[model samples]
Structures are given as C-alpha cells and as structure tokens.
Target: MNQPHTAQDDGVRQRQQQIAANLRALILSGDLRPGDRVPSTSDLVAEYGVTDKTVQRALAILKAERFVEGQKGRGVFVTTQVPTVVRASHYPVTSSEEPYAWIADNASRGRAGSIVLLHVGEVPAPAQVAAAFDLEIGTPVTVRHQLLSLDGEPVELVWSYYPSNVARGTRLAEARKIRGGTPAVLSELGYPPHHAIDQVSARLATVEEFIALRLPQDMPVLRQLRVVFTDDDRPIEVTVMVKAGQHFEVRYALPKPE
Candidate 1:
C-alpha cells in the first residue's frame, strides 16, 4: 500500500530540495569558490525565514550530493574544484570506491592498489574533527593514515578519521584490520554510504606531502576532501587524500538538466 507523507515530512523534503537546487546553482555559477565558506544554519534560517530543522534538512541534502562538506568546527564550504565537463553517465558508480582509487587508476593504471597502510590508531579528536563526527572535543577517534604507490613509485598520501565509538567493536573496524575500504566498513556499521560529496583543488605540495609523494619542489599536488553519508541522511565519514598533480586527474559524472 502507498502511504502518504505527513505535512511536516512534505515540508522538510521540499525545503531540502530547494536548498540543494540553490546550492548547485551557486557552485556551477562559481559564486561559491573552492574552500569558500557556506552560509551557516543560523544564517540560512534568517535569510530564508525557515526553521532550524528546515535549514539543516537543506544542508543535509547538499552534503549528500557532494555539493558541500562539513568540517568538524569549520562549518561548511564550497568544494574546491569540480570537473567542468563530465556527465553522470561517464563513469560507473562504483568505479573508484576508495578515496584515492580514481587518481590511482588513472595515474598508475593497473597498479592503484599497491599502496601500503602505514599507521592506524585510535586517539583524541581535535576540535574540528569532533564537530564533524558530532562528538565532544577531546573524544577518542580512530585515525588511519596511509601512503599510496604506483608500480613501486610513491604517488599519494591519505588520512582518514572516524568516530571511534561508532566504529569500535564493529565490522567497520574489522574491515580496517583486513585493509578493506572505508565504505565497506561503514556498511557493516549499518550506515552503508552510497554517495559522497567531494571537493578537489590544487596547491603547491607541502613539505610533508612532497617528501611522501617524492615530488620535486616545483610540482603541485591535488587535494581532495570527501564526506560520505548514509542513505538515511547522516554523515558517516570524512577523508582527505592528496596526490601529485603532475600525475593525477579528477573526474566526475554530472547529470544534465532536462
């Protein structure tokens, strides 16, 4: 039997959909640049004269679409760089499941999976990290840092963080033990993320990243930050992956407006 949506449910959905449309337009028109701060929930409520819950709904929708990402205490920001020309039909949905798989596949060809996991540990969360995970600052968090290689050549560096309480004693942590991908681990936690919001940008390689990727002084690197969310509209994970720009490319598949 088909059930009807309640008034409140309908209102929430409409507001969120509206927010998604407006946010997309802002990004595509370049009104919001990479790393630019987005309006806060309070600001949106005032500007749109909507309830706080309504604003949150909108932001949640944007997050699901990869249009914006929330930093722990850093609020949200426009994604840095998005490929201008790619349609949603260009690549398979699961083509690059892991954070760095896309660049690894393109740069290293059949060798993207050769990278080794360096350090994986649980530690106290920073202020920003805590906010992203909706936890108290100083809370314990699980952090995983890894290095990537291409045919024996180092090419990328990545750091991934998750709420320890949420991931501990679950398949998510077990998957990490087995070197399985984060998305799969998240699925085991009952929050299987099916979509991601990603932002890409370029910058001079940091001394640390340069040493890690073994890039020359003049080489730049690509930075990608992604937030993964469950279908029920909750944030699941956030990842930061960096790669040598000289050997990397970012691609996306956007659906054309009818």
Candidate 2:
C-alpha cells in the first residue's frame, strides 16, 4: 500500500522548488552573470532560512541545467551558454569554406573545438541505417566515430557512416584524423557533397552518455540524423550526432520559393 500525501511533505517539496526558482531568477536577471560565483551553500542556507540540503538541491538543479558549474575546493560559478547552430540548410558540408564543419561551427565561436578519434571500422548497419543507405539489412558500412569537445569539455558524440564500396581504399578507412575534412576527401574521390537533410530530436541521456558528457542522469540530449548527398542526389554520408541539450540549438534556413 502507498502512503497518502501529507502537509509536511508538501511543504518540504514547495520549499525546495522555491529555492531553485529564486536562484534561477537571480541568474536570469543578470544579478548573477556568467562566471559569477554563486553564494556559498552555508550563506544561501542561512540567508534563505533553508536547510543545507535544500540549498544543495537547488544548486544541483542549476548545474544540471548548465546555468552553473561547481569547481572542486572552489565554489559554483555561472556557466556560459554555448550557442550552437545545429542545422543550417544552406551551409552544405562541401562548402569547404572551412577546415571542417565542426571547426567552422565551434572554433569560429571563440571556443576551442576538437575531435578525438574513438573508433573506426567496418560494421554491419542496423535495419534503419541500411534503409537510409538503400542497402540490404546488415550490409557493411565504414563507421568513423569520434568525440567532439568545446573548450576542453565533451559536448557531442559523432559517428559518420559510409558505404563500404565508397570508403574502401580511401583515407576514410584509416583511423586517423582526416586532413582538411571528410568533405575534402569526398571531393578528391570525385563525389563532393552537395546538400544535406537534417533531423533533430531530444531524449534522456543514456548512462554511458551521462558519463561521457559529465551530465546529470535524466538530462535531455539532442540527437541529429544527417544525410549528405551529392549533386546527382546520391546519398554519400549519414552521420549520427548526439549533443547536450543545454548547449545547442538547431536552425534551418529555407530558400525563398520562386
């Protein structure tokens, strides 16, 4: 049997929520600007007449939402929000206007962007992935997997899949960072990317992802399914991108209809 709700329980819950709301308001109001240190837990508890645990809980909420981050032996400081353009219909991959799409999107924003090669190998595609590639289920695809970081903090997980035939005997088959970018490699192979289709969705982060991104459990994430095609409309690449929800926003620029 379950116990019924009690006034005492309701009061405690409300108190916790109130503390969180008050701190969130302070941050949003610019009273606590980015990089500004939040009050010590003891200070907040005493000033708000709340328990130490209540103050901690409130801080935890802010941390999970990426509003503030705690440094060991130091104190919590407001975290800077990273503005990311997750999707741009016009910024095709082969634009080759930059070293790589990641660098253009992240490094140009004044944040150090980096990619750490995680895994690269030929793997059998899942049913949906095969369908996307117009191949039989379980067909082999070259998978280039890596982790993306911003300002030394892991923010995104990326995996680019290529048809085995298209990837064989190319630099994409190697487990090393591609020079320039993958688009450059594709162009060298005579099949430059022309345009792409992008789909974005949000979901709770998995345990592995929680550890990878140093994110709180139950925090939502943004997942992108991107397909890059050639001028002739041949799909050449499919990439899966998983990013921290608090760190990104997707925007699509549609061409004005004639």
Judging by TM-score against the true structure, name the best candidate.
2
Tens-digit lDDT track for model 1 on 1-258? 534422233454476666656776787667887798888887776666667898787777666545688999889987654532322222212333445444444454334346567777777886656776788988888777778765566777877778887777765444243333566556666777766677788888888887788764445678877667687767677677787664455656566999
Tens-digit lDDT track of model 2 for 138-179: 899999999889888888988899999999889999999886
Q: Model 2, poorest ten-residue lDDT window?
A: 2-11
**Cα deviation in Å at residue 44, candidate 1?**
54
TM-score of each: 0.54, 0.75
The Cα RMSD in angstroms, rounded to one decimal, for candidate 2 relative to the true structure is 6.1
The Cα local distance difference test for each model comes to 0.65, 0.79
The segments of candidate 2 whose C-alpha lies over 4 angstroms from its true place after superposition are 1-52, 64-66, 69-78, 90-98
